[model samples]
Target: MPRTILILNGHPDPSGKGLCHALGEAYAEGARTAGHEVRRLDVASLDFDFLRSQAAFESEAPPPTIIAAQADVLWANHLVVIFPLWLGDMPAMLKAFFEQVLRPGFAFSYRPRGFPVMHLKGRSARIIVTMGMPALVYRWYYQAHGLKNLARNVLGFVGFAPVRDTIVGSVATRGRESIGRVLEKVRELGRRAV
Candidate 1:
């Protein structure tokens, strides 16, 4: 059956057109071509403080819009995350979205013993990350695949199954052929995504 996908674009500069856009464009087109319904949530366009006020988190109220976004997260069958890796990890807003949207009672449940448990089962995800650093150096020095653990452990803890991680490495300055190669890979990933 065709699935419904939620595409989360985490890049601040939508028009910059690098590996980040490569991830977003690929998955959006790929899911569409595969006959899946796609809904996009671009982080850069959303307004609101990335930090929920201390009072809001502690007591009476959090933003209603955040509640709404959580509802959307629940609706998606396939979650596709596209982003650029900055300072060895996800952009702040992207991280903040998880902090805000993936709430305690929504994305997961906790065992009475105090650990969080997965709840959003029956769904799957793909996280595609673009990095400016070379893959090897990033992995060796900076632990590039830590994002994979975020997707696999954190998001997976929220119940997404079979979470796939794609890293488009070495995105700093590139020659024409190299740029073309990355774009080609993006297209290929899109075509293969189902």
Candidate 2:
């Protein structure tokens, strides 16, 4: 069956030349080839302020860009977030994008007591992280903490189910052939709508 998929290019650079950009394009290409509806959100191209206080986070109206991004999030059945790992975490722009878009009443609602209510229960997510280190080293030695936090803490907390991830490490050293293989694998993932 066809799915509504949103591919979020989370790279901080807006030049459309990064590996993350290529990966996102490849995914969208494969998805469209497989008969799926695909949408894209480029974080670098958006203009929005970062939330600085709890009151702002909970009550302030998001900017127009954020509102539009939230609409895309709400429209999709599946989400693909692609970013380059920086300082052991997602780019600051991507983090800000999440902060601005996943506002209260959109992603969840707070209760006087107990856990916040999740409004996005039916959706699914996949996070793809490109990094400078070996994938296994990031997974085992570093414990893949950043990836886990996004997949479980943020997405899962907002009710995204079965959140999965692809870690493409040693990106700086991968040759053309190696990168091509990775792109093919990601394309296959897109074809499967995973």
Q: What clash count goes with each model?
A: 0, 0
User: Whole-model lDDT for model 2 versus the true structure?
Assistant: 0.93
lDDT of every predicted structure (CA atoms): 0.73, 0.93
Candidate 1 per-residue lDDT, tens place, 74-179, comes to 8888788888887778888888777777766677766879657777888888887777777777767766666866776678878888888777776776777887
Q: Over the stretch 66-167, how does candidate 2's per-residue lDDT look in tens digits?
A: 999999999999999999989999988888889888888999999999999999999999999999999999999999999998998899999999899999
At residue 54, give the lDDT of candidate 1: 54
Best by lDDT: 2
Superposed on all Cα atoms, the candidates' RMSDs to the truth, in angstroms, are 2.6, 0.7
Candidate 2 has a TM-score of 0.98
Q: What is the lDDT of residue 179 in candidate 2?
A: 98
Top-scoring candidate (TM-score): 2
